[model samples]
Target: MKIQEIREIIKLMDQSTLDEFVFEAEGTKLKLKKHNGETRPTVHTSAQPQEQPAAVVTPKTDAPKVEAAPAEPIEKQESTSSEASSSYKTITSPMVGTFYSSSSPEADSYVKVGDRVNADTIVCIVEAMKLFNEIEAEIEGEIAEIHVKDGQLVEYGQPLFSIK
Candidate 1:
């Protein structure tokens, strides 16, 4: 793909909740990732031909750089779940894909906090390979929390919702 096309994809990813994106066509592959809330995304490209070297593209314009604060040692906090909180069960994503809280942008979410659900309840939709798959809440209880936002990319076994 052309650098301009890759730049456009980066722009779209920045607007969405996606942190990383991988695209492969023919024998070329492109991967982009954003880190530490940086405005510019890092790009990596690879070609199938073993002798062909990958290219790294950097923006031409000079941007102001802000120095990051010194890292501080993180202190671990003890888990303090009460009996009520301990009873909550998490509904995890069954596949790696984008999570949609509703069927469409104009539609209401399938489930929300304080909503009761059962095994047959369609909690959300996970889109993979352009196919939208309805995700069912296998546990019976009230939704304690919605762990993921709409259009967020989720991995297999990632917590999507909590029930109690």
Candidate 2:
């Protein structure tokens, strides 16, 4: 997507009541959010084949964070997956929100390293706008790694777990 298009998206999101907006097409993922009444955007791209900026911004900084590192999962997760860890697939967040490893604080984590999971298994939860969204394994495998911690903020497309 062009910067103009992204700017337009920010404008639209700023005007709407929705606190967040996500757009993904081809190999690029764009996330925008309204926080404390401020409009912030995140950009995530992978080998797009199209010319685009590797705009990395942080919520605290004036950058997009590349999934805005809301995943900061964007930084470590990227390097974590790119180098020396190509054998496993990852479970990425479908939306931006707070990641919870269990149903509640007192509950046991949904899955841990070495745990086997089927495609439909609920491995975690992402809370967004007071909604608790169950994050499924989506792929059958044993949990190889947990990328994000419980109660941590995660951006769209940020990897939450690595499965082998």
lDDT of candidates 1 onward, in order: 0.69, 0.74
lDDT by residue (59-108, candidate 1, tens digit) is: 32364333333223223332243433667788887666999999999999
Off by over 4 Å in 2: 1-76, 79-84
RMSD of each: 12.5, 9.0
TM-scores of the models, in the given order?
0.50, 0.56
- Sequence-dependent TM-score of model 1: 0.50
| Stretches of model 1 off by over 4 angstroms after superposition | 1-84
- TM-score for predicted model 2 compared with the true structure: 0.56
**C-alpha lDDT of residue 102 in model 2:** 96
